[model samples]
Target: MFISGVHHIQLTAPPGCEPDARAFYIGLLGLDEIPKPRSLQDRGGVWFRTGNCDLHISPRENDTPPGTNWHVALRVKNAEALRRKLQEAGARIDPAPEIPGWKRFFGYDPFGNKLEFLEIA
Candidate 1:
C-alpha cells in the first residue's frame, strides 16, 4: 500500500510513425514533448508531459488493432471544446453514454490507441 499515484502511462505505436505520433499527441492534443534518456533515444519513441503524469509512446513492431476495449482515461477541464477540435481535425470520436455528473468522450490516436477525456460537472 505504498503507491501514491500514477507516474506515467505507456502506449505503443507502429515503427517509423514518429512524425504522425508527434502530430497527434503533441500538435493536436497540445502535449509538450520531453526529452527521453540518451541511452533510449535510439529506440525511436517520444515522451510527453501531461500535468503531473507523463505519457510515453514507444515504437513497436506490431501496432495495436482496432476494436480493442483497452483505453486510457485522462481528466480534462473542457471536454466539449476538445471534442469539437478533434472532430474538426478529422479524428474519430465516439460519444460516451451519459454519466450522472460527468462529460466524457472517446478518441483514438493515430496509432489506434483509445483515449478517454472526461470532465466533472
Candidate 2:
C-alpha cells in the first residue's frame, strides 16, 4: 500500500480527561483547537490543528503505562525558543539530547503524553 503522509495522530487518554488535554494543547502549546465534526463529538474527544496535520485525543478505557514511548513529533522554526516556552509553561523536558542536524527536544503534556519538537537543519 502507498502512503502519502501522516493524515493525523490519535492519542488515547483516560476517560473525562479531554479538558486538561485541551488546556495543554491549546493554552500551553498554542495549537488551535478545532471543532470535531458533530458525528464525532459524541465520541468524547478533542482535535487540535497545526498547519495541515491534526492531533486528536480520544477517550481510553484504561490508562497508559508510565514511560510509554508513544508520541507525536512536530516541526518548528526554532527548537530552542519552543523548548524554553514549554519549560516556562511548567512542562517537564525529557533528557533526550537534541540530535544535531535535526534540532529537537522531548516533552510531556499534562496527560503524560510525549510530544517532540523538531527543527529542520
Which is the leading candidate under TM-score? 1
What digit string (tens of lDDT, one per residue) describes model 2 on residues 1-121?
Answer: 7988887888878889888887788877789998999998988989999888999888888778346576788888888887888899899897657577898889888778898888887
RMSD to the hidden true structure, all candidates:
1.4, 2.0
Cα lDDT computed for each candidate against the true fold: 0.90, 0.83
Model 1 residue runs over 4 Å out of place are: 65-67
Per-residue lDDT of model 1, residues 1-117, tens digit only? 999999999999988878988899888889999999999999998999999999998998866754667899999888899999989998999988889999999998888889999
What is the RMSD, in Å, between candidate 2 and the native fold over all Cα?
2.0
Instruction: Report how far residue 52 has shifted in candidate 1, in Å.
Output: 1.0
Which clashing pairs does model 1 show? none
Relative to the true structure, candidate 1 reaches a TM of: 0.93
